[model samples]
Target: MPFTVYEHGAVAGWDVARPLRPGRSAGISLAGFRYRSAGSADLPVIPHPAVTVVVEFGDGSLVMGDASGWQQRGSLVAGLVPGAVRVRGENVTCVEVHVSPVVAHAVLGICPAELDRTVVALDDLWGRDAARLREQLGDAPSWEDRFTLTDALFSHRRGTGPPADPEVVRAWDRIIVSRGSVRVEDLAAEVGWSRRRLWSRFRSQVGLPPKRATTLVRFRHAAHRLTAGDSTARVAAECGYADQSHLHRETLAFTGVTPAALAADPGLAVDDIAWASTAPTETA
Candidate 1:
């Protein structure tokens, strides 16, 4: 697997796909680089961000959007925020872009309110500006230009820098090492802090509470296993769930689909799980 830098910025470095597995994606970050779906391969939707960039190619290509609770299909290349969807095959090849919260903060320096949520498409906010952006950025544009475009599109939503709380980082690190099972109290003690302090900082930097963040990370791990054809019972046990049902309930809550449904569809089940140094988002 050859890794290439797709883009770079003060916040991160985006690298191109180096096939983590047969149908999985490994780490590839150069902050704020946009990704279009590959036209040759059809992909299944997994638990993912509300806003993402997708493209299609070949016949029988379908993309499903799990907006809120509704799942629908179409050429949903523009709007993908914090939702899950299934992408049907039409010989479509898809590539997903990863955005940094810090870069988003840089873009929206003063208006912290805009940072409250996620943006699905550049055109959604810019309208005609989206076309102009595509036109300026041909098949492959300079990394600097890509970062600039991303920054400009998200500029109005930036806020204060991520929290300076060491406890938050410590807790996040614990979850990563534990594969998402460290107790909040245990983490607090390790950092010599209280649970309340840990929560405050975790929420500030990651925009989700420690418990929820832990759950999300755990779900992502399970999704990876399920997509890779691991049985629900096995995944549940490995992820610290009480049982398969426990894992099923949590997966459905975040993904709106059962483990069986996900595993049944190879594209969605075995797609890439984007694990980042900061935040992780699962993509197909």
Candidate 2:
């Protein structure tokens, strides 16, 4: 697939590129980014509902640090809801992949729960294969080629890796379709599984239990809406929050910032362009 490059002056000096076509799997999405000038950047890593994989190339360096002062550099993977982490780098260039937790287990070759909401070196997970991938991406002639290579790698992994349970996938899809408003009991009934069984399987396979997953999904939606300049009160009501205070509490808990600050965050400002069609939409 070809890439559509944009000079994104609005978002922290990033030159972004997204695939003309979506990845082969609905569970995976990719975007490429390059810094226009050689300089350092420290941007907050906002929590999202997917596992994030970043493959860094070029002469620049990429480092991810958490609130606890734990840090990892170079190509890395951050699990779902990686809390209070920041990405720092100089002239960074990389292909960022967001793998839906439903299929992250198969594509990443490990249970998402094992990631434990922390950033880790990709080499720690993929071993030497991670280094080879960075080399391949760097050697690629264009952003389009880089995206193609990434899609191929994930396609192969998902094909050969063990699959998440069918019931788990269904439940996750329903939560997404409902924009995280679906209750655990409803999901269990729809999937024909006991509540306890669903909770255990979901936590083990998707990394977060059903309730936590719902919170993440809902928070993700609310964050994007806030980023789009929605009013806190309206967003709260439309997104299933009890009130503006409820929205404020969840936003603060997830991002460590109030709704207004989160709305102005640079990390989320680029989502409309980079994620475009893949971001979930409200279901009727």
Clashing pairs in 2: none
Tell me model 2's lDDT, rounded to 2 decimals: 0.82
Each candidate's clash count: 33, 0
What ranges in model 1 sit over 4 Å off? 1-45, 48-64, 67-81, 84-95, 100-119, 123-133, 141-166, 273-284
TM-scores of all candidate predictions against the true structure: 0.59, 0.92
The worst-scoring run of ten residues by lDDT in candidate 1 lies at 19-28
lDDT of 2 by residue, 18-112 (tens): 77566787789898887666578777787878899999987888889867778899998888988877888997989999998888878888778
Clashes of 1: 33
Alpha-carbon runs more than 4 Å astray in model 2: 1-10, 278-284
Q: Give the TM-score of candidate 1.
A: 0.59
Could you tell me the lDDT of residue 151 within candidate 1? 39
User: Across residues 32-104, which tens digit of lDDT does each residue of candidate 1 receive?
Assistant: 3223344433334454322244422223344454455554442233221244444444433224444332232
